[model samples]
Target: MKKLRDGPMDGDMNGNQRTHNFRFLLALAILTPLVVSMTVMGLATFHFGRLSVGELTGTIVQQTVARVGAQLKQLQDVAQDQNRLNLKVMADRPPRAGDFKRVAAALAPSFEVNDELDGVYYGVEATGEFFALLRGTNQVVNLLERTLDPDGQWSRRISRWSGTDWQFLEQLPADRYDPRTRPFYQAAKTARATIWTSTYEFWPHRPGDRRTTGVTCATPVYDGAGQLQGVWGVDLGTIELCDYLAAIDPEVPGYPFIVGEEGDGTRRVIAHPNRNMVIDARTGMLFRDANGIRDETVKAFLRQIPGRFAAHAVHTASHTVPLRLSEFAPDSVAARTRTFEFADHGTNYLGGCFVTGRDDRLLIGMVLDKKEVMRHVNRNAAWFAATFAAVLVASLIGVFGFARRASRPLVELQREAHAVGRLELAPSDPPLSHIREIRELGNAMALMKTNLRSFRKYVPADLVGDLVRSGQEAMLGGERINATIYFSDIAGFTPVAEQLRPEEIVEHLGAYLQAMSDGIAQHSGTVDKYIGDAVMAFWNAPRPNPAHAADACRAALANQRQLDRLNEQWRAAGKPVFRTRIGLHTGPVVVGNIGSEHRMNYTVIGDTVNLASRLENLNKLYGTRILISETTRAEAGSAISARPVDRANIKGKTTVVTVYELLCEAEAETPEQAELRRQTEEAFAFYQRGDYARAAAAYREILQRWPADGVAAALLRRCEELAAKAPPPLSQDG
Candidate 1:
């Protein structure tokens, strides 16, 4: 005290005040051990936990592969047994066309013995007679019979088992289907033993019924003199296998697929988690290549597997390893297992491959994305780390209770200040302290936080940030800005809402609104408000976007694309699809905070906005998805592909706006889209020039090409009405 200086010491404004370094040193001393312990603990825990999880994931994949192999082997055994049973019943004699009833009686019990059998059939090689007992998804059993009449005409009849007796289902011409030409029959005849056919599309029971995929295990029935008599076969549908794969660890996110040696001796996908991927849509045949896989993630996983599991080139040179799995049963004749690891796009994956079949022919592959594996490990590790840190903190608090209590108010004040700086102004209780100054500061911060939170709730965060940075208060006012306004409404929303419950409507509309908002926000547009199923948004408001028109158009396109994906998902889930129509216009509008002194909304309003709303409603009449005014099309020139639609007088505006249908991004226009534009424009030209008959003809031609062209249909009807009332056109020569 006696050595107090007249001037500040050590850069302090006052010499009477003690330096704060002592408090800082105390904190450092208390925190040093805790920090070091946590850092070391985290590193060690992650390192060891990663190693353990790696092994665990590998074990899981291997076990899964083994499980699938066992299932496939069991199926093979069942098929062989069924074939043997059928062969013994046939007794080396070919069944006649008239013996179908006897064959059906013999095979009906086979379904009772094994529910997995989709079909059991016998094909006679000499007489070209076939008999099949089949089951369907409806729990109905069908008996199919084919006979080669003496006149060489193939007669086919289908009958279903109606619990008590056989009921005739239908009769169809069987000229296209011959058992001798089928792979299942040809394979067994060539091999002269039991052989499994590649997966193929099963014949549909009736027209418009969904077809199924199945593999046939066929055995050649030989006479005692070594002459071939007939082929006996059992069909195992892959739908059950697909369901089984889906049921395995339903939460795991990883999927399994089976590729097997087919009847053609080439490997192809036999079963997949997605039933659609296992069969070709165009030919109704089993998919033969990975090109049919739609999911990029699944495709990436498939790319790691080789065409043949025996090939050592399953991975790149650095990651390549011999295919071996010693954990598999050592004495199992049909089981051959392999494990491999590789990196794709910086993500490591663990995969296992197992071959199990009559000749080790079927390959089963399982892939686990390492991130999913690590996520589980890291979650557990995080709990451990948090618990360890909490323990250390509790110990320190016990030892230095008084000191911490004294400094707690200041710490809370600092934290609150930082949170306020980040605009996270959630109300928190004021920190208590014995020191009056600390208590006062805490109270002041609490007060500021309360006021700021209320302020934040009332105003846009971006606008608040701008005003705060400029050190200005927001006032009720308006400024004219050239902005692109967007308006969108769900088509047929009333009926859609009527079909849903209250909670369901909330969930459905919430997702739809979120998707639309995301599209607008992604393109630098501001979402102003939602009016039921309608969205009102604008670009170049609080944020200045030079390419506002282009951005607005892009947002509209993006919204439609996202809606398309959402519709597909909804359709598959058996939910109603939301179809939306959007309108865009670029013009000057007043954008600012508007309302009375107590309430305010940051939005845009003007004739431009009204015009956009009108354009959206016009889409109903024109049958269009996106309609943009002439001003918007001009401003967004070369940024979007658009075709001239019509010139219409907006409801509230005096001027007529030439509207255009927004198609796609300029660079994304395809040849077909270009052709559509050309044809539509040609027809529109005729209608525009009062050539009603020619315009009607052109629209009819368009409808012939695009049968579902709603726009063409709408315009064609208008042209037809105009042509009927008009005077007959004079001949060109006259």
Candidate 2:
């Protein structure tokens, strides 16, 4: 018994596996039930709470949609009803043709009463006579009337109403101004009833006046004798509608807009909180395409409108059909309110759409971000979670204080291991523990951190960190992926290296490499390797980047900017300036840790890498600073400015590749640089078409404008040589 007690239950062995097992089991047993019960209860509460919140938010959105619909109806109905009233009154007692005074007096009260009315007009179908009263600048009444001039020809006169009299503003030359040819006039005459016209840009009263998009409500009036007399119309532009929608609580509850749909399945934004968003400056018409919209939020909403509305469409036995505005009855409760949900740019949104004007096929829509709706619920949930966590922690602390003390060193070692896994090797002291295994774990983590710190210098820290965090082992294999490869080299680097001392060369080259590496890393690019003065980098590897090409181009431009600053400093010190050239190409390549099992490199390899290297060499022949493959130029899109350089067959590649000289970021380029690029591209096009003479002339023009343009000079010499080798054109005498 004495031998067994001394051998097995000794003090030294107590701190071994038994102590660790006891501490771990004790803590796990005590904390399991407490943590599990609290987590389950919290999840149950959150699930039910979220359901209740969603229902409440849906109701709020429905009400908001109804309110917006009501407001739109009130605005649109005024003009329609006014046109009907004018038709009825005029039909009761037909007015004579060209009775401008009586028509203006009759329409003045209705037009002035409603601030939404942009204008009111009367047209005599029989005599081709017309008169219009419009709310001009500052709400001042303006008139456009057709009258006989002294030359006995019809002329349109523009005048401002001075409350009691009309003061002439400007007179337009006679061009047979006839309202009978207008769309509203013809539609009203054909229907012989009140109807709404499609939106159109109203002609500005003055040359510099802003144009506005408006719709007209037109109705034909007949004489008591049953003879056709004339048509009366009322105009309503989007200005008032935009202002009313803008006045709504746009930031918190929802953003409101009005969309108009035509019978032919065309949709347009008629009114928005941002008035300018709906108005197309180029055509002065309503925005029909969501792509042309400047506001990102509005564009996103418009893009989702079609899909969301189609999804909620009333389904039939045979096919699913979207609910159209024209299908809704004017006064139907269903027409006045409906709610739906959609996601835009990863954010969920709740919205309401209701038919505001069936005749005009307009629907009022309000979009509310889900984040805003759930904000209060989230805040309350956070408070409840915090309170519950605080109580649970307080209870567990007292119950497990002794167990926690026994295991604190192991916990510290676990944290150290996690830190090392993240490649956060900023020198930390190893945790001291009485337990043998715990001390061993801490030492292992310290040594790993030290090794990774040195390993990061050879391999990219990001690549290694990603591999470690994902728990993936570095293996000798790769996968084909679309990536952008970048290569850069200093111009005349060999000669420059020879001129400087070994230490001086190292200092300058070291700073240059560091700056280039930093620029690449800043754009999520991995530095594959450094070949003397040349550095090769790649993007969309280890981490996926959808915009890898653009990122690479931006990094190249940034590196150039960085070199400019360095050169300024070097110039002040009378040191040799190192002009660097960059090349970028985007294509599918094999990227991963590629080497034997014992030694591996996280790099890319393929024809794309070779082409990128070739492009850097071509920059010297073209006298350009940066050249990129056509694939890279296309992937980068309009974010970077580049001009076509030339097409050449890459070594070992059967197909010819087009190249472009990357200038600078599109937004950063000056007008002069843009012009130079434009001329160079134009000349290159001529050269490609075998018009060497014209190409030479274009290059000469470019040189005249930019005297120090080396690219123009080089291309001009090439054009002259090609032109001299060409056979003379056949004489016209033949």
Candidate 3:
């Protein structure tokens, strides 16, 4: 028998220990240089790949943006040419009152020839009269005339083109909408040349007609004597312009948008791929107030270059850059075209900015997701990495067969570690290793897996799964997503807590929260966090739920019903009963695990969350148990029965949001509850429309039927106060 060294082989050692020692050191020495060389080569390959991909992608994006810019410039030029040509043809001899019809007939052919022109009009400054031919539809044309009266008043006459002849439509009421006051008219009068107006909504002849956004090209018309007479203009509908912008190749993975300077020196979005991004979501109105724009990308562009651009620099970065928007305003650098980079919600983007139109006021920009653009580069890089790794593994296998045999136990331990990293811990006995260091490594990995198993209980399982799948220890950033947030708080928890002992309070509160959490979990909602006596949860995050809004509403109702059962049990046990108020709102929010490096929490933030909290607190004002925003009600559909509470301008937000009280499930409502809901809706409708007296009567009727209805009673008081304080009507004589 031979004696063996425990720790290391000394000058004299046993045959087995020496053999193992030599093989392990030899394998390490061989693998070290191989890994080092492969890492250096891989880094170099990745660096060059990024450069080549970035350059090619940037060039393609620049060309696409430039092409869009050129098309926009061509549109402007066409408008100017049309305006100049018509002005010259009319200026050859100024048109008198009788010659107006001839001038209109001369312009009528222009519309038939040019499909780009939506309308042709000429305004006479001398007579305060206007004649125009507008395209009502693809086949129908309308002729409009505004005549000045002897008393300096104006009235409009509309005639429809019925293919064979012009049919008289009707005379419109008098209004102060004057063509002379338009920006295009003013600009042409001031510049004495053909000029283009900023895009604006053009209303049709009929009342309550949908308005189409368009641009006008106008030129001041003068007689042979060079005296200013009137302005001749042509209208170009933005439908064609928007269509052109949207028709850009989908393969490009970028969108083109047109920005124009408004009269107030604010930037307006003239064209966008999704028209709703340019319009107010709540109002369905196109945004003219730049500060009121909700689109963050558009706002960022406008804020970078205020008014007119003289010299602007574009910022570029290879890695993901913070999307603060404020950082986009760069130092002065003059360039006709520039490429930039930005990051939003963990995705990198490349964009190009090109000045379009003659005045240099309009900007055409295209943004592409860098990941989408460099997809081929990433694939190539992956192939290179995989090939190198495979070669390294093959070389190791060929050189170290005996060493691999010695490391068989360690390989099993490595697999265990990987499984632990993936949050898939399966119970297994630690493998025995002849090597002391290898055995200790296996022990440490087993300890880590055990600790991780315990830690999983402290964290949300879904969030843990996300982290494991993403191969990240923790998420540090948030993503903007459309989610429905639910907030619930005990209506009078403070008084209840004060009345009970601390232990009892804790017990009851814990039980209440547990019940509510169960309800939320049943509906696939993530219980984000709990406050002192409140719970906040959300749906459609960490996973997608198409019915997130309806699910949230159902969860809130479920929570209330569950709380009722819990309160009954508490009452039977001689404890305090709890009444919870819940608020639900559906909108865009930023959700992620956010906090310090050491301590983090998965939560949501944004105005949507704030509004939900506000609605939760607002329950006290209306004495309602549940309240939800208009967006939530709309998304909840017919599953939930809700009555309008009020259209309130929440404290922080400028826009008003309509709130509704979640009464019950539509199918579960009794006849009395249905009638109460009907009466409440009618009263609220009157209240919103400023009919306080009728609203008061309606609320009184509801109180007569259901006197305990706190919401109706509250509204009745409000209506009475408003009606009493209302001003007296003006006398007929006055």
Candidate 4:
């Protein structure tokens, strides 16, 4: 029509051009709905294609890390627990060569080797057999002993004749337990720790013919002279531990796997899906591979593997690629390997090595990506998707009444997609869509993009966000954080519990945790976890707490204040009130979710937890309300009100981590109490430094002034004894 206005064939041409433009606009109107529908479908595909798998894998990895960390920590706990008992034993009586029997007897109740026993046993290099406590009975069982010798591997069996209680006997070469040479013996003897040994002989062939085995945990025992004595420890059967650990993923149908490397055979399947496939879970006994199983399938997977391992590694570097087996998916999706699992059969090629430790041998491997065990089903789903798309496209051509209605839904979906594509994390409060599914999807997308802003209130939003993107962050695992630990418990809770109804008890406990949690948070601390009525909190993790020590001290004081207030209220209501004892410590610990995938917890662990608990209980001795470790006092400087209580070792820790009392703002007698603390510190230091004369004089003056000082009394008695004995420069050197 405009061209006609330039002077040729005017009216008719103008009408024709107008008609054409109207048709073009109609076409655009129809195309708008189709384009939007396709865009919405594309967005959904993105989620299905990549995000879903990534989310699932991330969740699994987090859980796996947490579970593995916990299991290893439990092993550490068992070692430390036994070490404590051994320490007590050494303190009570010197280690004599003949004390092995008594020691083994003492370990009988908890050291059994059965399904429930969990491969708990102690071994001594002086003796030629490994020791186990019989299940449900306090009987010492010898796994490999010269007493049952004059035989070979399979000849060994469980017998009651060996002792008044059940005993197991297996024989092996003499050097395996020669106190002078065994790996377990050597490691324990060298340090005051339950040391893990390198890979050696894992299974004993006979009762007396002791052979080498894989890694073990050995805790040393000392005699009165502090001379090196035999070791009390636990031996882990790689096969057995692997089998039990393999059961961790029981929801999946296939057998779990543990892969390790024995010296002679480099590429072998150490443990497999079938419990009896290669070795017995209980005894590590060799079993025949049953017929009619998937031998080809197993071999096929193994054959597909590629390896350049640092031998075997549990803590493999991120860049390290072990035997990578493929699930052989078609090139329809952008995925190669979805998961990693260890071979279950005896000594498979894909094995985990405890690279973090001395030995470079495979301990075990897990079967990863079991959800896709049935590829056929996944392939069918893919095919069904493709067919559905074809039908959808063809239906667009029909343009029937129902088609338009269905297409209308797709049309609206497309419009929302375009709107989302235009919108971003800008601060505008855009109109939220009315459609429920659309609104939810849009919100989810927005949340993902703005997670840093959303979770900022609960966590240090920026740091956690970066960690998530880098895939270095884990929801279920814990890190070894530099933490100021705080433990607070209801002081007279036992008697209080007896007095209250069950519901009331529960109510009180709930109130206690909630109050503790709020206080800890306000001071920038995380509740590491709770133990019954006790609350354990920490600072400097999941967020930066620069004033962690100061905050920890403040929190302790706050809890005491809160508890005092709560009790006051309770007493006013005619309900009995209880006291709370708080303990704090600063140290490095392995913190994480301390449980399995299905059932897990975010918590902290190590000797730190034990020491903190010990500190809480030690309030009984000091008559102080709250106690902090010497480390915490040093870090807290003047911000925390504390006085060193002692330089003595706790029940678990080998090194003495001195503890102190934390004074609060509300105590008016704090200055006078602090002066008394100063005097006590000087007196204790004098005694510790071997100036017994000055120490005794100071102690006597303190007792005269404060008759109720128990520490002063005990120190006075010790000082007098030191006055009689040789007053060396200092006390015992640990």
Candidate 5:
């Protein structure tokens, strides 16, 4: 009994088995139930967590699928309504055989049904009686329009050879007695009401040519008296529908298909994922089986059908106890399952489902990885066992000295481990464990913390923390933002860029960017993107501010100020000086990645971005260094002093944007400049009144005060030109 008790810590034992020491063995014995219990609890917690997560995920997927299915089903309802409306239109008037030609002509533009499709047609209840054909893609070809009664009072077969392009079919007789043999005629007679038929291939004969088997939809015509008259039908190539479904996922090599058993095993590839992969399903429906993707994935995917999995629960039976095991493939989506150590402070049972679909919805399963669940499980099992073993060993020890010394090393190791997390010490601390195993653990932890700080270097620690906390900025794909766009291009950048060496150019650009970065940050603007010589800046973040536009405007002006200072320094050093022009516009844009997955730029894009660039180009025309859009002006409110530059209808922008030039702070414009601006506003008033003569005179007055003002000079030329062709100025009421 004594040997068995001292077996693990026997001093003379070899090192291989000697890893198990007396005090440590007792600790492990106590920890055994804890570890086993932890493992079992982890499994249970993980299962429940997975159960909840999987249920929620499945619910979301099912709801989305149900929604899309409902929308598609709604499409069928629309088709029914359209068919009913066409029937109503046909019932209103029964066209006589002679009236058929003229009626088809008048109804040619009628889109009473299938607005997105080629065209629509109608047929008669009487077999071979009332028949008519119409063009599908472009025009209507009169197929048949006679009430065919072979020996009736006035049999009309005379117009048979008229040759008005009904080319899809073999030329028809004017009055046909046996039209029931024909597909459309036969189908119409049977339906006697609005009816949709299987895909047809009958060609409507056109000028000197013929059309072949095409999908046709027909509806029986009725008169206002509630009488069934004829059937209306439209014929189209089935390939069109196939083409449409094919566009669902252009990247997927997997093509879509329309699967169903219809009409004597006459299968047809009615539709496909993309137009490029269309197969005539009617003749050759069974084609692709490569990559084991044929019968199951392809067919099931095409039908958008949910699949079943072999569900199972297996309880692991060990010598000590029987634990539980559960698994099932409810969907093909969660294809791969993996086990991982989902541990922070303790071991845990975790199952990672790898699936693909919409929004990672493919891998959707029950979330079984909650911290509290794992915590409860690990503590109950692991902590219980460890404490039990510790107390048991405490009872066995003859005195306190061995127990104290034996446990001291572990306690010290734990303290050091805790200290590493708090950054209280560098990771260079050596493991102080006299035992090799404890020493190895301490060494590994120290190395791990050392590597952790390295990651914090590349990405700012606070920024990464912010991203993790605000799940919205999850460092995956970016989002759209209503931001102010700023485009600044050095006026002589092309010349300066050409003149400078590559290294010098980079240095110059870096300096310029650094300067601009300081100003943009000062005004709460995010430098969204830079286009070589042009700097694209925006306000609103990673964070938001109601003063985004104001910040953007201020940044643009500040950039101008920075450029001026830089140019002065460059000139003093006898370097080529340059001027920069900036344009700012505030609008909503898709601000996200603008490059390949491996390499990307976080930037903004939309019509607003283009408008900002356009406004930047207009800088030379206005002779103003900086321009702000009407939206920017509005956002900045009355805080910044600005003069209305023009009411120009910028290209691509339908509504005229009132362009403004930022002059100074609201309280900072000189009196003379303010007066000149007032005069400029008066000139704009005259410009709106169509009094070009007066407007031109006012512009001349401003030019007299500031002759170096090119804007006044340019406006004067336009006003003078318009004045030569002007109407008299309007009175106040007028």
Candidate 6:
């Protein structure tokens, strides 16, 4: 006599936990040896394979170093290409004072796309003038323009973009900084091609403030006549290079650095993995202070190398070898494309170097601690041995425990099925199972029980039982049965969705749908589908409901009442209220499962379904909530109050059908509602009879009483148009 509930299973099954545990223990005993054997084989391969573990580790380090070098070269190439393109665009026309803003706007896109570009500038050789746009922290963009005034001193103006437009920040007094004197300008002007400046401190905002190490990519600008107009340059920050390396593999015990040859041929650290090493702490600037070179690992390595190369020296030997500037000479080992191992601080390390830039003055290198690089491999080997033993023990315990818990649900399901076979429709809940197959079986059994109890809501309970007992399948074909179809839509739902946030829309729509579904279920109706804020349903499908029309009418009425209560609650909470409209039609239509084999929906469809949908839309025209066809009104009898609204051939149909507005429940109609319905019907009747003047008078009266009555207003407008039109074109044709 136990009944099922909605949710997970209720009670434990007959099998004891100890019995299932024993089964699991037996399974674990069978699997443990296979797992251990696999682990041992893998460890043996690592220890004595053709490719030794050390070689594999070394290959990985070499590949990583190569990738880092490639990325740095690619970055520089992008900067060069960007500068060359900008210079071409700017030099297309002669440099003019008025064209500075337009040129900067053109270059803005390049800066925006390349996050590493610190700034872009154009210098004019014809005039002592320079224009630049710099990107600052937190999305701040600053424009700097240096111009020579009548007094022969440089004036600088700074401006910032204020989202919509540019706003002038300040104008500084004359300064001596000239773009022609800068290294980037001189190099590009001399080469007449793209060139990279040596890394230096770039502190454009305020002197002695925060400084960052960066290099500039510059290209000479030429006018149409082939005259050197000026130099165009882009500053690229090296901090991004450090960040790029840090993000490569933080868990690895290695670092990357870029060393470039100084003007004096001495190698200087340009980009370091530890950014602070290249930054001068005193001024917070990069490569500005000599003390900044202290503690820099690559510089330290270079310093240890003797000034002169020893003859026949073994540079590739594992023993510590000094890395001097001479080793980076054209044919030295440090400049060659290879990796070497050396000892540093009693720890063996591996270093690989690659030449970068067209000038071959830059070496991109990575140094990894030998012990740290092997740490993971060594730890993994130890973990493999310990884990195999522990897994062997734990598997036996876990399998036994899991087997006991997993079997209980299947046992309980069997008992429930037995009870169901004996005509005992009600049975205790099946136990939940964690195993996939067992859970699926439990779910099937639960679905069977639910169908047995709730089938009457969808079809006649007696017929369902008969089909089950006879073991016969319901045929796929539908029958022409007199049934009532209902459709409801929330008004202004699109706007409502637009106004509410995503979560709020979900919450409000959920509550609205649940309220409507509950109302339909209360009247023994079957919900077909929900399309957004609309619901479609029907009654008397597989079941013979003699009062299906009345039932649908009652459900629609109850649905409105539920919405009214919800609207009241929403209004009190300062939330928007949803107004719903319902349309109902009763007719002989095909009702059955209709769709492809993979997916089928047991619903009603035909001209009757379309009519119901159209009727729902008609509510908007009449300014009413619910509308029904003449057939539904007749079948519904006096249980519901309705008034004739209009008769028209709806779209996709040739025959005209009469439609009525559902006023309310017969007993719940207010006196004022009754009076409104009477007046509306009277006006509609007068308009239909071709009494234009009287109809207009009647509609006017109705509008005076209910100014918002859309139907009345429409009819009144039609009557006025008819009266205003001259006698007729028919008389002229005659």
- The lDDT per prediction is 0.77, 0.78, 0.76, 0.56, 0.57, 0.72
Query: What ranking emerges by TM-score with the best candidate at the front?
Result: 2, 3, 6, 1, 5, 4
Q: Give the per-residue lDDT digits (tens) of candidate 3, residues 1-734.
A: 35443334644433454433556676778889888988898899799878888777777766676566555556666666777667666657766545655566666655666666778887777765777888777646777888876686777888776555567889988766677877677888998876667787775656865567788888787776877798888888766676656766645767778776654566777777776677665544567765665557656555555446424423332212112122222221123457777765566777677653444556667777777777767887889989988998897886577454546787788788778767887667788977787888888888877777787766666787777767767847889999999998887789899998889888878888888988988999998888899899999988999999999988999988888888888899988898898999999999987898889888899999999999999999888999999999999898899898887888998998999999888889988778888888999978876778889999999889888888888889888999888754334585
Task: Name the candidate, 5 or 6, with the larger TM-score value.
Answer: 6
The C-alpha local distance difference test score for the whole of candidate 2 amounts to 0.78
Query: Which is the winner by TM-score between candidate 2 and candidate 3?
Result: 2
Best by lDDT: 2
lDDT of 3 at 245: 69
| CA-only RMSD, every prediction | 20.5, 18.4, 19.3, 18.3, 20.4, 21.8
lDDT of 4 by residue, 1-734 (tens): 12212123323633654332333344456656765776577557644745455354433443443344345445445545655665565455544434535555555544542342323444444434444433223433443222324454322234332444435443334443343466667767776656766445544434543332345667766556776545665555444554555556534323334344434534444445454455444444433221222334454444434452243233322322222111111221112112344444442222112222234333323333434533433564576667657755664554443333343444644554444344323432323555566567556655654654464444333344445545563457767777788888877778888988999989978887788788887888887667788887777876667779888888888877888899899889998776888888888888665677676555678877778888988888767678888888888876755656677678877787777767654334476777778888888788767788898999998889888876677678878888888545544673
Q: What residue pairs are clashing in model 6?
A: 20-404
Q: Give the per-residue lDDT digits (tens) of candidate 2, residues 421-495.
A: 767788888788766777887888888888888888999878888877888777788899999999999999999
Off by over 4 Å in 5: 1-480, 594-597
Off by over 4 Å in 1: 1-460, 724-734
lDDT of 4 at 217: 64
Best by TM-score: 2
Task: Give the Å error, residue 245, model 3.
Answer: 26
RMSD (Cα, Å) of model 1: 20.5
Candidate 6 is scored at a TM of 0.45
- Please, what are the lDDT tens digits per residue for candidate 1 over residues 375-474? 8777888788788778777866764663444466677787887777677777788888877778888888888777877776555566766765566766
Spell out the clash pairs found in candidate 1.
198-263
For residues 214-311, what per-residue lDDT tens digits would candidate 5 score against the true structure? 44556666566767666666554445454444333422111223432233432333444443343434443323221222333333232322221111
Count of clashing residue pairs in every prediction: 1, 0, 0, 53, 52, 1
> In model 6, how large is the Cα lDDT of residue 268?
59
